[model samples]
Target: MNFTLHQLQVFLKVSETKSITKAAEELFLTQPAVSIQLKNFQDQFDIPLTEVVGRQLYVTDFGQEIAFAAQAIIDQVNAINYKLAAYKGQLSGRLKIASVSTGKYVIPFFLSGFLRGNPQIELKLDVTNKAQVVRSLVDNEIDFALVSILPDKVPVHAVPLMENRLVLVAGRDFQPPLGVSGIEIFQYITLIYRESGSGTRLAMEGFLNDHKVPIKKMLVLTSNEAVKQAVMAGLGCSIMPVIGIKNELKQGDLKVIEVKGLPICTYWNLIYLKSKRLSPVAEAFLSYLDREKNTVIEQNFQ
Candidate 1:
């Protein structure tokens, strides 16, 4: 069977997006054109590459193998292009970075300069929960995983960029009930928490457990922004990282509730698999992070 690299590229793009229309748009081709190429590629094979079920594209078992092989070829070709650019001391290639959702506050500041400096590099960022970010790291899907809490089971290298300070916060109208004990405070107010997979949630629970304070009658929100909004509406008090609340705190839309043993501190890390080799772009990014992390955090967080 003979097929062009273009066919494989289209197939991989389709696999990635799970939508032919999206793949066509990404490849700058019309939907009909993409469909024609897909048909031609299928004509060369007996097994089905993909199927549609319930309005969603699902790759067949054989299609997965084909996609994997296609990805390998694409990666090798990209590696060649990166090496060619490297000979000229330029950076060009795909850089996929995964981070926990809360990283939105910090990663952009850390990346702005590096991204501006390496304009040729194509950047893809995945912002999700901590579990997903760590899974991406372990699966070798991302070049860097920016996370606050590292997975204990995963053997990886973690570079600490800055401190993640978790502080108790409430709506402007609420007063800090820093009286009696931590347990007593929990008894008086409803606690708001980030969803289960969140790094912030994990840190909060760990801190509470260490102090033997039990959480009950709590509200859980999927994202930090949502939680902030909920707290600003005076739904409940929450433990949130200072990095995410700077603007709110400054504007007095939200205020920190000084609890007796609060402001749990943790490190934000730029993590990657220890066994996976870094590409030139990834290596350059690591160096750039090392050189600029302190200054960037100081300028943004300090």
Candidate 2:
């Protein structure tokens, strides 16, 4: 079987995106042209690479194996080009990354510094919840992830950046129960929660479970911004990462509820796959993060 470099590149993009249309858009090719290339690749190998499941496309195990090999080849080719370009003293490339919601607020500061220093580097950022961030990292869909929760069996190298303190917040209109403990405060007020599989939600649940707080009436919402909006609207109170609500708290739009034995703190980590090689741009960004980690956190959270 014979395939061109363009075919390999297209296949890798499609595998990463899991959507033909999206891949086509990214590659600047029409849907039919992308489909024809994929069909030719499949026919040459006499194997099905992707299957449509519901409205989404999924790469088969065999397809993933091929895609992985293709990605390695592509990375090597790009590395060669980068080295060649380095001989002329130029650093330029695209960097793709994923991050949890809270990191959306802090990571940009470091990235901005890096971008200012290297204007030639293009950065693509995908900000989602913790679960999606982890998923994207594991699937090799993203180069690195900035997240608050570290999975038990992470197949990646993670560097703890800072502790993400979860604070119980409420609208300024709401009052904390007087002389009551953290556990008791839950009994007096309705709780607004982050959606399932969210790191914030998991941390809050673990804390509640540890304290033996029964959760009966709870409102689940997605995204930290949404949670802050709900709390500001006086819908209910929530426990979220301090970085997410720092502005609200400072502006008096929201207030931090002081509860005994509360403020669940977890570490935020800069995670990347152990086996995958980092591109020069990615390495430079990581170095910038390592250097400015403390300063960024202090300025953002304090």
Candidate 3:
């Protein structure tokens, strides 16, 4: 059976996303185009590569094996391209990074200079929840994982990027009930929190448990931005990183409340497994960080 490289790429994407529409969006192609290519690719095989049921797509067991081979071919093609770029005295390769959702605000600053300098480099930055980020890091699918709270039982090296300061924030016009301070404020107000798997939620839980703040009424949101919006809408107050809410604070949409022992601090760390090997692109990025991170920190976070 013969298939074009584009077919393999399309099949790989479809396998990853499990949705023709999403694969089309990522590939910048029309839905009909993706569907046509996918059908063309599947025609090469006798057995079904994919199955549709109740508006859901599922890859057949045989399709998973084909996808594995397809990924290998794609990697080989990428390696050849990188080698050719090197022959031309140009740095070019794919650099994949996974960052927790809240880390979206921080990763770009560290990457902007390096990415701008290496114009040929392809950067895949996946902004996702902490659990997915950690899973990708553990599976060796990503070159780096940006997070504030490190995963347990994972032996990884962490390079501290910046301090993550989490503060208690409410709408600008929000006022705590009289005599509410410290743990008492939590009792008086509905507390907002990120989902359970989030690094921010883990940190917030640790702080609250350590301080023995009994959260009575709680509202859970899926992301930091959601929690911020909820707080701004006067739904509840939340513990949020200053990095994410800086603009709202400046715009007077939100205000931080001074609670004793509040403003929990942790360092945002760029982490990688100790046993994992770094690619040339990854090595170059690490060197660049070592050389210029101080200036980046001072200019951005400081």
Clash totals for all candidate models: 0, 0, 0
How far in Å is the alpha carbon of 119 misplaced in model 3?
Answer: 2.4
Q: For residue 295, what is the lDDT in candidate 2?
A: 84
What TM-score goes with each of the models? 0.79, 0.71, 0.92
Off by over 4 Å in 2: 1-87, 176-181, 298-301
lDDT of 3: 0.93
CA lDDT of every candidate: 0.88, 0.84, 0.93
User: What is the Cα-based lDDT of residue 58 in candidate 1?
Assistant: 84
- Error in Å for residue 177 of model 3: 1.7
Q: Could you tell which candidate, 1 or 2, scores higher by TM-score?
A: 1
Candidate 3: list runs displaced more than 4 Å.
none
Per-residue lDDT tens digits for candidate 3, residues 57-169, read 99999999999999999999988988898899988899999999999999999999999998878899999999999999999999999999988999999988889999999
- Candidate 2 lDDT, 136-252, residue by residue in tens: 988888888987878768788888877788888889899766777566788877799988878889999898988888765689888788888999999888898887777787899
Query: Candidate 1 — number of clashing residue pairs?
Result: 0
lDDT score at residue 145, model 3, on the 0-100 scale: 98
Which numbered prediction scores highest in TM-score against the true structure? 3
